[model samples]
Target: MAVPQFQHLAGRVWVCPGDPDPEAVQAGVAVVADERGSVLIDAGQSPTHAREIQAALTAAGLPQPRWLVYTHHHWDHVWGACAWPGVEIVGHETAVPLLRTEAARPWSHHYLDEQVRANPRLGPSFRARARAMDSWADFAVLPPTRTFADVDELPVGVGLRHVGGGHAPDSTIVLVPDSGVMLLGDCYYPPPAHLRRPDDGLDLVLVRRLLQDDYLWYVSSHAEPMTAEQARSAVETT
Candidate 1:
């Protein structure tokens, strides 16, 4: 896939579109900025993906991002943390232990191959992506520098809210109230296909919340921004 570019969505918000490459699935990265500096939504899938964000920001003439926030602990969401050294990383409190466990283990091409062999979730496609990366020399999960349970307010009035969903119990959304934009990571997506089926009840509950909240634009990790009408239909049909 071509390197994704950040498209301006609303006040102080821009998002790099997600990659559809199955072997290297990548989530969209959102940037919220003002005089306080920019805060990135998710760090992308790998160093190459993160650097794509960096290059896009530079090309757009935006300042370096000041913070990196994980919407959850999924590999595609948090594995790119090493690319943002010194950037304050934030995540839901539930993510700390999950990440720490991975941090304690050794990661190598062989280790990854073995993981794919032993873990159904990390299937053949995951192994393919691991082998495709230009390098894994700098890959590592740096646990969040700070974490919160329910809600955490950041500079520029951005709000990080933990609204755990079926895809991930630590799922969170980035709320840019002033701009009426909400960034929904993988929260609305169904659990991985190999995992237990999605909970329809849970999906409905979150969909209701999104509709009631009525954000002007809803950004999901794997798709383009949506209008209220579009967002509602998108989630309901999922």
Candidate 2:
């Protein structure tokens, strides 16, 4: 597998390259730092990915993240919490139940089998990674140590808001006040049925409000960052 590239977006903010294949679910991890410490927007898909992120941070002269905030409880975003042993994991209260469900296992053979059948070209590489992940006997879901209902302040002037009913039941958005960047995770896009609710207009309204703010950059988990104007236009058209 190719090593993911981390790009610096602004002062003390960097984003790792996201999965290029739409069929794949891995998200780019956002790293934000301040004098106090650093904070990771989302843990990567696996322990190996998490370790690579750590190395990148060290190379960039940023401190190990003091907090790991999950945008949602999807397997690809939250599975790497095991890599940061002592980091204070934070997420919306609803994510706890989702993470503890039986479906939240570290590696799922059934899911891999389906992926192989669906996309023959990418199946082999996906299966190879799956087999490696299976060997991680110590892998387990690490529930967030701190849970919030609506809004919470995090280290480094970062703020988290639980924007319910979007990409995931516990979908949240991370805001960097200083840089005017907001990590939208997978919230402002087409989501799985189980993860989406009927009242999508409310979510759109919230998104529009955020975009209208002084935010300069809007970063999506699976795509390159967009300017506030581009974000607003996309949301309105979609």
Candidate 3:
């Protein structure tokens, strides 16, 4: 798959890199900004990437996000969420369990620790920030004061609909009804749907069920912008 790059699509939507890995747990991040403010969809893997997202938001002239939507509770997506202090942290109700407990598990914490391993020169800095800035449940996860299950519409200044969840059990997408744009939270894979097994993360089968047609463009939390046609094609294959 091609490396994802930030692109401004029509209707106040944007996608940008959330980390140096750009794969697996630390894939990337997506942003939905509008006149009202911005909503960060699925924060990156760690505190460093989270901070990076804040910087990007500033560059875009968007107000600090009023909401931070986590596609699911995976470490890569919500771990750095603490970086966005005041925004509401939204996610599938099922996802909260992992957010509250997963970080404490030896494997979960260890795996996250492994993700920080990086290029020789970048290793030191990545290591320092990764362990120092573990996910702050109190500040990040608590704010989601608003939540829904299976389906929900988050109004990010502009409307952002949380669509299908083919990645994780709690995964979903952020849809823009007007521009036909959607921000997929780990919906597909590095690109989408076909990159992994049907049962890998979320039920790709169940997630694909929501779309009866391909009328929406998309911005994946890990991938790049895909047109309605592209999305429909992937849906067909799935």
Candidate 4:
């Protein structure tokens, strides 16, 4: 398989490509930096993906993240956070309790078994990576050191808004006002009528409101960054 490449969105924002496994549900990691420090929008799917993200940051001459902001409590987005020690992890308040759930258990062989069964072709690789991730003591739930009730501001000039929908309950949207870039973790996805849940209608409305602000670039977890206009249309229509 070809090596994944990190794409630069704009001013101090770069995205590390995610897993290419057809059965994998990983999200790309977004690295943002400023004079204050750096922040990661989300850690990738596994320990391997996290290592790749770290390498990419070093290659890009960016500092280690002082903060890891989770978009939500999904395994694909927050599992790799254990790789970054001493970094203050941040997320919405709802995510705190969710992180402590049995589902977040790193060493749970049952979870790995289920994944392997779900993707038989990639089962061996998935099991191998799971074993590696489980080996880390810190691999267990690395709950957010800092939690926000609604909206919060980071020193890097990015705003974390609790959009509250999509794939998870604690869904968040990251807005970098200075860079005019918005990182919409898994909050937004392309067409597939079934993917559009009725419960997320309000969330879509909230996303539309944020997109009304001055933004040039819109980055989603699973797809290439799109222009502000394209993003707005996607949010409004889908």
Identify the candidate with maximal TM-score.
Answer: 1
The positional error of residue 44 in candidate 2, measured at the CA in angstroms, is 0.3
lDDT of each: 0.81, 0.78, 0.59, 0.75
Clash count list over all predictions: 0, 0, 7, 0
Candidate 2, residue 138: the lDDT equals 65
128-159: candidate 4 lDDT, tens digit per residue: 45644645554666668899998999877878
Best by lDDT: 1
**lDDT tens string, model 3, 92-138?**
67766656676454433454456545334434434544554545444
Pairs clashing in candidate 2?
none
Find the 10 residues in a row with the least total lDDT in model 3: 189-198
Q: What's the lDDT for residue 170 in model 2?
A: 89
The CA lDDT at 22 in model 3 is 35
Worst 10 residues of 2 by lDDT: 193-202
What are the candidates' C-alpha RMSDs?
2.2, 4.3, 6.6, 4.4
TM-score of each prediction: 0.91, 0.83, 0.69, 0.81
Candidate 2 lDDT by residue in tens digits, 36-66: 8789889888777788888878777777888
lDDT accuracy of residue 77 in candidate 4: 83
